[model samples]
Target: MPAPQRSNPAYRAIARLVRPVMMLVTRRDWHGAEHLPRDGGFIAVANHMTNVDPLTFAHFLYDNGVAPKVLAKSSLFAVPVLGRLLRASGQIPVFRNSARAGESLVAAEAALADGECVAVFPEGTFTGDPDLWPMLAKTGVARLALTTRAPVVPIAQWGPQDLLGRYGKVPRLVPPKRITVVAGPPVDLTDLYGRPLDAVTLRTATDRIMGAVTRQLAAIRGEEPPATPWDPRRAGRA
Candidate 1:
């Protein structure tokens, strides 16, 4: 299911144009970018704080010598002009409720094999916890890291939440807030490589990854970490 590494013309064009605009519009800042693997495919796992977070992450990675293919919600690709643009820019559409989870994983692995960075939101939704800390994440991201042997980067985003709150859906062109994207170092879950791919291990790894994200978010937000119940264990039905 992995995508080929052939040049994505549309992505190239968009990145070429968007980087400068992003820089001019916001004082975009990044940290721990050195943690990004210089020459291979990896999974960039981040919390979904706002709609604009994806573009910010994409532009940051692209500027830092890594262009990421995003795992976007399938519905966004249904829009008219935006959908066409997203498709051209090499974004991967995922049907959240469909049985196609495995198919998405395949595409992610392919992109990693080709040395492209694939960005994923482990939480799968915008943060609803008023505090902006990471909630429990899904196991799809862990599955990708294990299967593709890709370095998993933990991204902690701030400022984007201010531009558009969780309910904003999208950012307003004349919005009052500026957005910022911060990339943390890549996390290596290679230790779990040989572990059985069962519910227990998957959930454990997922929690560990989210724990990293939570730490980063806590630092960025300058607030004490949210209480443990912020992300309680869910029944395993997958």
Candidate 2:
């Protein structure tokens, strides 16, 4: 099967601009690449470590086989040049807390139906966990994965947060960071995929997806994940 290609000129343009720059400062070690389907639709769900990781994650996905279309915060699409790049590159902007947030899902469904890989960061934003562990995730990822019946592939990424802090900081490039992205087999949502999209099912499926990613991280981080994943509300971190 052929690798997924981008037809959007803006995507092509960004690829020309960013790919070379990325290769210069990042060394990629990707595992379980076989889990990435060569063709068709699927949702690649990953933990949020650093905002910059998305760029490199996109690079990893594009290099392996598929081009990822992500659901990003609306604010990102309102910026000047960067916004234009995001929009022109076929990204879906999410209008939050208004009447239009639902449109992001609609756009993502359309992309998935069209055989595109839709990448979702279930943690929604950067993990508030001080240790950089993934916090409790949003359920939209489960909804999207089940609604479209697409494989919910779990991937864990490490090393990007070291290079870039949540708030803008001088990025460290010397000694070029080793960014490792590992993909585990798709989370076993088959039992829950066709079930009613009730809160229980959605939450359960979301946990499984997060669990898979955590497992991957545990293996890579050489540590044990918390017995219960960090919950912002319970921990008063919300």
Candidate 3:
């Protein structure tokens, strides 16, 4: 097995504090660590089910030898202690729907070039699917993968929602939930690599990435996803 990446002091400190709490509140059933790239930078994409899943996802990657630099929402970097820790730990902030929105992409690209693991939730937020399956995702991940020519690893996780419901104010930690996280092989975007970054191309690439994630989630849940992934924008129009 590949050795775990060496994290910065701030990240290590934050992980030391968070990992124990996670262990106390959750049982981990992680698989497919072998699929993660042992040395080079890669984009780790996962389905977002609840607010807490990011922590579980990070735990899985960190435990498996990758120190993930997640692209988080800009608002998260504004909180008090959490904000300071996030900045200190080198987490990237995403300014959504603003002129600064593209900044996160640039940072992520640079991180990838430096051979760091960059984690992204392409759906951009928790899945709006009533069934908690992955929804249609934004194409930012596609852009990054193509631009950097980095491998895109698809991860699917189940059980974080049980510990903390999608919109719940309180966590259900009476009996620690079992968090099952599995990684699939790097998404096959080789054919689309040299293509132009147009709308159709981006959407095509995004669909393949999300499909891989949904398939992994389906295997974990032993259930089938919808024929058409839910689209928040389309639902809003209705």
lDDT per model, in order?
0.75, 0.84, 0.92
Residue-level lDDT of model 3, residues 1-238, one tens digit each, is 3335558888888888888899899989999999999888999999998889889999999988888999999999999999999888789999999999999999999999899999999999998888998988999999999999999999999999999999988999879999999999999999998999999999999999999999999999999889899889976311
Ranking by TM-score: 3, 2, 1
Candidate 3 runs further than 4 Å off = 1-3, 236-238
The estimated TM-scores of all candidates read 0.86, 0.94, 0.96
Candidate 2's TM-score reads 0.94
Please list all clashing residue pairs in model 1, or write none if there are none.
Answer: 1-106, 1-107, 2-106, 2-110
Q: Over the stretch 6-100, how does candidate 2's per-residue lDDT look in tens digits?
A: 44678777877888878888888888889997667889988887779788778778888777898889999989999999988899888878899
lDDT of 1 at 179: 53
Which stretches of candidate 2 lie above 4 Å from their native place?
A: 1-3, 236-238
Q: Can you give the lDDT of residue 9 in candidate 1?
A: 78
Could you say which candidate leads in TM-score?
Answer: 3
Residue-level lDDT for 216 in candidate 3 = 97
Winner on TM-score (1 vs 2)? 2
